[model samples]
Target: MAFPGERSQPRGTILIANPSADLYGSDRMALEAARGLVSLGWRVVVTCSVDGPLVPQLRAAGAEVVILDVPVVRKSMLSARGMLSLGRDVLTQLPRMRRLIKDEQPDVVLANTVTLPFWTLAARSCREAVVVYVHEAEAALSGLARTLLTAPLRLANGVIFNSETSRRVSGWPGLERRDRARVVPNGVGGPPETLAARERLDDMFHIVYVGRLSPRKGVDLVVRAAALLRDAGIEPHVELVGSVFPGYEWYEAELRELVDELGLAGHVRFAGFREVVWEEFAAADVAVVPSRLDESFGNVVIEALLSERPVVVADHTGLAEAASGFAAAVLVPPDDAEALALGLSRVHEEWTDYRRAARSDAPRARRLYGPESFHARLSQALAEQAFPVPSPSMKDASWSPREVLD
Candidate 1:
């Protein structure tokens, strides 16, 4: 792959495989890493089982993209029919993937998420360096899922975790003992040059939530929380700025019904999938992340902080870890609409203070999770895996303020 800028001699070929092509957190990071590697003079080829919005971006970044008809294990595929379909997919994809691995002859095989552990097996047979970037925390996995995901890491050359919470919850003590695991927190694009003043929205306190509208994401709780605020005689404008997942359109309908049932129709707006979501974050008084699942890292939280907007996240899972240091952030109990409401109420009452604190602490998040830091760490991790070198700086800190800030 080559970009428009001056290119260098190829370092080595790399094959990056992801489960889905949607532009979600994991997929987004995968593209970022692929683009970074390309810029570093690596010939990159990206493969995924499905296709979506990220295909054009991958090509624009000068990475060759190939859509493969492989079977990926999903959480929704736990039923009888789904299991049968999965079995068929695995049987067909096994030999096909093995052949592709042999043909590519890549120096490194990068697996983006845990759902596609088959890449590890294929890379092992080809004697190529294998790196798995785990984006989900252990608390979110079932017993069988956890076994399937970690059993292959024992053979992996390197393991990259998105957050410290993901690293600890992964229960992979052997990776640490072998000096194979590294925590590379997710990074985001820099915020706009200028942001709208938060004080300008004094008349209507706008609350924004960004991500998929699924049960696990807890969008319903946001609706309930908005209703609770309405009952408390405060009518805050809540703007939801994301669409539902592939099979979860009903969840969006359900949330709308919930809003109507609670008489919050006028107070809530579902703004589906905006290209410039950061603008929404910059305009809001506060951002909310009420995930019921154990998130590995909340990228939206960082985006909000970079936009200088205070955040309120659920206490459970990696959400609490994502909002640890910011004085502007408030932690509320997971799956509790009342708790979320109270947290929002607090932000509403002390809006300016939280906004000021958010601005003061925003640079810390950017300095740590910026693109330079992410690409630098990623290059080092891959280089060490390809050729084991000894260096004192490889030692990870016992605690990093950035690790807790997602």
Candidate 2:
């Protein structure tokens, strides 16, 4: 079936540019969008900086994957030397981006993250409509840095914020002026069948945490919380189901040290990264997403809820939004281990009730975050941003950065 606004004939092509090929939160969302678009009769092309698991997944979803060295904004690039390097990259890559837009002649260019400012510039220079799918929200950045980072978003014909918090935190004044922005929560796919939370024969409570093992993600707090539970005479087995970024290996080491210091050697385990986490959620009595930093949206929260597992997440930003109104979710202050422990303790104390609530809420979570609901909302959002496709005669028109600058 064609999407609401899709024509009977194949809809025009869409080129999606993403920064990484890792199947992380944003990567998974991008893949979902590609799959939905392709199913709706749109030819999809996905571009990434490197090859990883997401490459094959995108291709499997019927997207043409292109490995390109796109200029992506990173925290390290704020330094003087890094800025110079970034400048050089932009100077060199911007032309290629413009050329790619010209060659693909897509109806819309969807830049998956706010990091790729040059993608918006290139698409505009090519006189093509561009939409930015914003998935990051760092409220801690200095005013100047935030402005500099988000300035390019003004050039986008449309902006798709992952959550209401993201749309608000973006601080772009023009977002509501021309109906240029829409908030579409990330669509998360759950297991084919809801795996009922297993009853533990032993007193040990299984707690699962998924996503990056970074400081900002507050993985250490989970360890501390585990220690707190132990101090309270509760046996909790905490499983961290993700790995850290290349430069952040030290964080994982520190987490291990903290686990040892807290004497949680047997209680806490780092399972590294997993492509599929349904089994982990299935076995988990409870899940925790204690992100200390701002998140645009929490896909893991929805995943846990859909898995019929009670979840404890930080009560701020998009995490709270994702967990809001869910009967099985427990929200605690960001970065507070004691509170996390307390929350988990409450779940343990009332395990039967919580488990029942989790099972009852699974259907609701599925209705809101399941693949069908997500695809429908996404289709409507994209259809709203549908700009008139350029005529075939105008497809060969030459455009350059100099013209855009002038």
Candidate 3:
């Protein structure tokens, strides 16, 4: 069945460009979207700025992986030097990308992140239709960076937001154009039924936080919350199952210091990056996402719910939307250690009830975010033509580095 805002199109070749080669939430969504397209008999090619862990996963999903040196303009790009560097990189790569697009001659080009809108702009000069998969909430973008990023979105034929939060945050040029932009929430596979039988361990309650260890992710807050729990006579074992990205070791060090200062070093375990964190979810009685920034979509929350584990999320931004679907989720104020501690205690005190609620609600949560539904919505976006796909123009003028830098 077609969703509210989609129309089916005949299958054809499509090129999907993502910013990174890592298998994070956005990367996984791109890969899954490629898989979904392939299932519909569409030939797919994927491109990334560099080669990393997710290349093999993309290949396994039957999509060709192309490594291109595309500059991903981050929030840091709002500065003069950063903008100059970004402009130079875009200018340097434009000709090569244009040639690549000409050679591939895809029917559609899917740019997979807000950081890489240059891909969509590149496709604007090609015969291909450009569709942007916005995985970020534009509220997180700096003013100048937001303007720069939103400029290219004006040229997109379609825009797919990972959540309503993203849609509202990103003031895309064509946001009011109903057929052009719509929301398609991220999807995840169902957990094994045996996960529902996870009883609280008598020795220690297992609390898990599975995401990047970064300042914005509030990993330090999770550690502080653990200390608060100890103060309340609850000695739960908090397992942090992720690591900070390279170049952010200082943040990781800070988190460690916070744990040490609280005298909860023995209570918290840092499990460095694991390719699959589902096992970590399965082992935990409670899952926590203490994010300081607005999350576009909370994949960890859904995973924990599917695993029949109660979730505790910061009560702000898209996190509330994510955890709101499940009754077992506990919401606490962002960055408040005492509140988080109380939340943890509440979950532990009502363990039996929360576990039962999670188990009972697991099927509904799984169905709401199942792969089939996501693919269905994605297919509709890919097939729909909100605006006419521009014909390839031989006289298309490339943007000057000066024009971009200015």
- Tell me the alpha-carbon RMSD of every candidate: 7.1, 4.5, 6.3
Please give the lDDT score at residue 63 for candidate 2: 99
Q: In lDDT terms, which candidate is top? A: 2
Local distance difference test, candidate 3: 0.80
How many clashes does the backbone of model 1 have?
A: 0
Count of residue pairs whose backbone atoms collide, per candidate = 0, 0, 0
Runs with alpha carbons beyond 4 Å of true place in candidate 1: 1-9, 76-88, 389-406
- Quickly count the clashes in candidate 3: 0
For each candidate, what is the lDDT? 0.80, 0.85, 0.80
The best candidate in terms of TM-score: 2
Q: What's the lDDT for candidate 1?
A: 0.80
lDDT of 1 by residue, 17-102 (tens): 98888787898898888888888878888998888888888988889998887777676774557666777768778788888878
TM-score of each: 0.89, 0.92, 0.90
- How many residue pairs in model 2 have overlapping backbones? 0
**lDDT per residue as tens, model 2, 361-397:** 8888888887777777776666555533334774567
| Cand. 2 TM to true fold | 0.92
Worst 10 residues of 3 by lDDT: 397-406
TM-score of 3: 0.90
lDDT of 1 at 398: 50
